[model samples]
Target chain A: MIKNPFLRTFSLGVKSLLLHKLRSGLTTLGMLFGVASVVAMLAIGEGASKEAQDQIKQLGSNNIILRSVKPLEESNSNQSTRVSVYGLTDGDFARIVDTYPWAEDVVPVRILQQEVRFGERSLNPRVLATTAKYQSVTGRPMLEGRFLTESDEETVSNVCVLDYEIARYLFPFRSPINERIKIGADYFLVVGVMLPRVPIGEANQAAPGEEVTGEVILPASTGRKWFGDMQVKIRAGSRDMEQVDLHEIIVGVDSSENVPAAAAAAREMLDRTHRERDYEIVVPLELLLREQATKRIFKIVLASIAGISLLVGGIGIMNVMLATVTERTREIGVRRALGAKKRHIVMQFLVETIVLSVGGGVLGIALGLTIPEVVAAYTDMQPVVTPAAPILAFAISVGTGLLFGMYPAWRAANMDPVEALRHE
Target chain B: MAEEKSKAMNVSLEATAKAAADTRAVAEFRNVSRIYRMGDNEVHALDDVSCRFNAGDYWAIMGSSGSGKSTMLNLLGCIDRPTNGEYYVSGTAVSTLNDDDLSELRGRHIGFIFQSFNLIPQLNVLENILVPRFYLEDPGIGLVERARDIAERVGLGSRTDHRPRELSGGQQQRVAIARALINDPSLLLADEATGNLDTQTTEEILELFDELHSDGMTILLVTHEEEVGKRAEQVMRLKDGAIESVAYNRPTIQR
Candidate 1:
């Protein structure tokens, strides 16, 4: 006999459970799988949402992007004409800078699909033409040397900055600084190398064509002087001519709080001036807010699916406990006849259930943690296991055990001692 | 060593002699009646009957089936309450005590012996013997030592670690006897305690009961066999929940 009643009762419970090893093990398996799925599913969901949120954050939260789209009516009408005229002109950029007081800085951009050549290597990358303030608006950082300066833009110097991927591909063995790369018919000296940037999702693309390989930055004045605003494409049997001044304009707000208002004012100004809707506006703040809301909904859905499995596991425990109480009716009688009170019988059975569930919970947490690490190692998907995931899973497993164990314990305590002793 | 053994024996003998001189009732039942209701039909298990048991006396209650012998044993052990009247053990009325208090009283003052040697199958002999004290407070090394002493007294000292399944029917009954004596109760109640044993084993158990009776312990044995009832100092016969006759086999020493 143990001196402490608690330890004595606990040992008694363990002894009885050990008498039927296979039954107890099978019952514990239900809780094990339930908790493991909850933790693993939550981790996978959190990881996916975190990736999307990170991409949105990369785009400046206080900046709004306005892109030119060729009006469908103008393009259809110009099928027989020699040249097509549409899209944002220098006049729209000037109006936004002068009319909107919330616009802190506005940078006009032009992008041309062109191939850059270095010795025997050639790659088609987007040629971005913008001024020195583009870096400040986009928060892009340079890897080496300096960005294109004001003097470079004023003189329209034949100099360019290449993204890391482009620099590595064009100049494999040598430093890109001072190296000359040819674009179209002109050769430009490399003044700086910029770090790779996180590309925007396809929804933000202005042109529908092949994937953008990389980016090459140059001065706006240099691009206008050499290539002009008119681009002609002759494909198969048809010749298409398009004239556009600016392809994109990035507007910066005074603060994050003023971004939505600034975006609305810009839209109102464009809507009033342009007869056709030939442009699209994207607000990073709005996309971010929407993505966060979607992530919250996804978490609830995943938790509920896992919660059903836990409920099934709890039912399994209750079923086994009910059978156990019936089978041990004689033992309960003997105990009562030997002076055990009703509370003692209840505690004995409750402790047995807690032992089974808490044991399964600990094992489930281990399995849950290992699954994510294995998934991350073998696949492209990243699974993040937060500390709270395991804690919450373990807590729910224990709670399920207690909730399901109550009815059976009460039944055992309420049995008549005389009738129980007479049970076969 | 021999002198010390005789000195301890003498002290025990003197204590038994002193207890035998004091003639107080160990237990008394006054107008006790137990009724069982089966679908609006009341079955009188025990009628209005009264009895008193004094210290150092051996008694046997004999009856046929439906004679309420089982109900009487349950009531005397404090496991079941009478529907009418009151009973007292150690001068405390059983009617005033709640369920928990009755359980405590049983644990502290009464010992039970069943025909089947109702030992827990999962526990060994020593643990089974310690079951009566399992619900008591302040269990210490002294309690275990006392259990060992009683086990030796019942000639099961070598089988203390063996489960009941490994022992013979007589050995199992001996283990039950040791268990009943662990609480050192003043009243020992036995219900067909030797019914399952062979003739030889029955005589051995009866001799052990005789030894306990001579040591000034009060005992109440319920049986249907005339041979077993002849061993007690007195016998009470019950018929239809009431006493039919009271027979004295020998002159009562203390009552």
Candidate 2:
């Protein structure tokens, strides 16, 4: 032939694939789903990890937090203990703020979890008591109205701020701002609403054993006077009861860069005041790093599981291709008898495989792209899809097709003309 | 005396001219043998088969079912190589040629027509006829004109675009004949080309073959029917893979 025979034969192979469109399409479906799942799963995992990391980073990568530790022995043994202990008191906060010049800002907080009643509606809400600087230091934004001012803290005014979910739940239809809500027995006036925040860390707890909920914020001075040290009693029986104190303090550093130094300064100040080792420190930055490493391993394991499906898909392609070779034996023989070379026959089958693989790959990419969006819409867990995942999946599918298609093409090329011709 | 000598010279010149015309033999087989091994048994398909067929000659090879008529045809068409001695087609020693070289030779000089009229089912009549020309080194010749001419000669001009399945048995056979003649080959080898046709169709095909033979085209036909053998200028009968008899047509008979 004057022209390249390989090109002509390759075209013939493609033409043959086109002739059996249904068979080719069915064969490629396995590869398509295999690739799409691999890409979508990996992307979702990566996206989840990224979201967690960002939340941890926002908590201040350099910060170390120390919370109150009131031992159960002290509370149970004596109700009226002479020495007040376990948590950082107003004196300890004053000492830390005064002694350490490196300490940029020390925000001492007292937290209470209780049912606050507004009209006929009642919902359990976390109550935070801190200074005016607390909101800016921890990156909490006031959604509406104004935050607690220095005047409010100094005067111990009965002013409160509600979190977004709490406001929505308590009011339902009306605005909760400037409204009075009874906490235990005293009524406090609402000033502002806090924006919504997604919970992080173990058991969806913002802290250990604490069920995160929409919260109400009040001035520390006002909380101490009105709530009177904030104690809750869990009744074991009619006669026996256990009392717990609401003296937990969440200290906010001025900046993430100063968090570690500020935390160390506060610990040193608290150590001088308290003799017993009855406190715990938690660093979100450390937790974030460890979680990231675990996520990396998680994504790899998930991708491997998806890879098994692709391998199965490849085997499916091979099985179908072998069957096709047997089916087209007479056709092969006729071409051979008519002077077609072995390479021509081989090229023809290989082209068919490529067409199937590439077509499946394109469909798979489209499917993979929409998977994350569909998942996000239907479920609470949002899946993130990355471009690299789809590209890798497509390349791997094509490679698998080539690897599996070789054997059948070789078998077709090696068929004996006489025997093939005689095959019915 | 001079006038008598001139008459003698004219006669001798005419005889020499006839010899020169007969000397253009397109194929020759010299002591050719083909052996087929079936387990421990060896069957001789063609034992010392020797023959010479010239251009423009119409010859028939007659044999029974187990005889070596198909084997001889295969050897002449270069589809199978001979086991012993030499076989030449158009002055080329085919027994000495490799597979690729033999294919090239076959494509260039021989055209084959089987009893089944083996046309590719997917291809139309015109495409089927153009198959052999694709193997040529330079297919610069006007293929369209060549296909049209051959189609016209075989009375398949109108059915050039029709697939083999769409045409009748006689029409399919006509397409096959047109395909065989497309390359203007040195020799045409037909193995019972009209065996599947009706008597009327067979007569029509035989008449076409006769006309082609008269117009300076050589043909070698293999058939078991005596009536088919009778239409050729020369007939060779085979028995037990050996030549049994050879007959020539009478002077008044035209093939």
Candidate 3:
């Protein structure tokens, strides 16, 4: 019924708080830091998860990757042997593509960990030997020249497509497009350069130590003719030999919904044909779903930690308000004598606390948004700020104000007017 | 035809008003007793005390410490209720009202001037004067105008925007007086109002009170100063929670 009572009360509260500038400012810091931490933490978490999901998307949601894993028993026993016959065979790739009706395309890859040389520069890169369909299946972009063609595979051409990083490393002085690179005893022509496949830190490989820094692509028929099917690496004094027709097979489906069935059929066929468990399946769609679930839980954990700080900030407000109530006892008494009801006194104190928290909340949101930009500037992290982060933080700050201001407001309202007037 | 009927209604309304004016006092206490309990003992702060304050009358309640003078002022102001018996302000029984309704009654009918002036420290002279109206439903238009008028009347017209701390003891008491009159209260209750002021300022404040009394305001003041008491038209002295004697300083004018 009063004329602009809320506005009047709010202004009155602000006036009183302004009387003690330092105290009000210090109290505001508590909520400011609390809300800032919440928003900044969530933004950073969302950015990291987005980076991971983007990498998974690059792997093609409808594709299933089957990687050969050397069994522990075979690896331990084959250290002294001249040759170890284990892992995915050429027959397994043929069986999956021929029997599974859902499999749209199958590209078999053979990885030869070898060092390539151009003049004095040398670097060990994973050489991927696959068909022309490998480029279409993996969805990697071609930077320069043309990718491997079916004619190159049939003619068994001694040519390779270098990863962009590998190309830059080898031919820092000039273009390596038409240059010849030495792998072993033979020299291969550099036909093309493709974009670096999922930078190491961003890509989540299924097994540890499986991240490939740089790759050199060659046609499957040409690789078989030149490098043969056996790979030997000398470590310390022992030579470890592995003989496998294929290292990995990427199975593609028409849509993501068909990936699970294709993967299941492929797994079953491989299990029946291979005696030992030497292969693991990686599904991009399943990984994406799991990553989303993990991100949600991670956000909750971050919010809760931030909520605790807010609770402490709320307690700080309560503590200061209680002291203020006691300090303003005579003022309360005067208002009561002047005909103010209990609720009027409550509204006065409640308004003061809300102003404190909401003011802090606004400032906190500003600071929260700035933290992400500063992080992105200083580090290689892509911190994404969603529209909801600041809004959520601000709502919580207001809630904290109301929740914590109740008891002190009630105390101020219920004071005995006579005793309060007599209070020093 | 409507004008004639309304005139008849006004005539009857005046008759009822005159009849009610003859019997009712501004404030009355009927055998009011206020007791405070401490441990096993009962302290009768005001035991069976009865008194009446009429319109345009200035009465001073004189007593020693623990003589229940302050308690009597509080009860008459409607800030405290009696332990027994009844109190009436503007002819409405205080005992029948709830806390919120009691506050409303106090706001509309009683004006309190405390010993320390009790002007809110943070509020300016005009703000303090307008404080009572803040709690009023529909405080009405021209509230600031009326508050400024009261401030001018109290000789604070130029200092309306100055806070209480910036004012002298006499000026602070004047602000309190202006605040009390903001709502046009029927009864003014002062508890040692000039006790904190110097002799010169107290004289000035008491002159203001005399002017208010001459303007037909009912005033009750509790004080131990005989000089303060001598200025009132009637003086009532209390001894051990009961009235020992009441003396009249001036003859009542026939109404």
Who wins the TM-score comparison?
3
Task: Indicate the fraction of true inter-chain contacts that candidate 1 also forms.
Answer: 0.29
Best by lDDT: 3
Could you give candidate 1's per-residue lDDT for residues A89-155 as a string of tens digits?
7999999888878888899999876779999988888899999988888887888978888999999
DockQ of each: 0.35, 0.11, 0.40
Chain A of candidate 3 gets a TM-score of: 0.84
Q: Is the docking of candidate 3 incorrect, acceptable, medium or high quality?
A: acceptable
Per-model fnat list: 0.29, 0.02, 0.53
DockQ of 3: 0.40
For model 3, how does the per-residue alpha-carbon lDDT over A69-119 read when each residue is reduced to its tens digit?
Answer: 987653345445466678888888878777878777899999987778999
State TM-scores per candidate.
0.83, 0.66, 0.84
Off by over 4 Å in 2: A1-110, A114-122, A129-162, A170-212, A217-313, A353-397, A422-424, B1-112, B118-154, B157-163, B175-192, B204-255
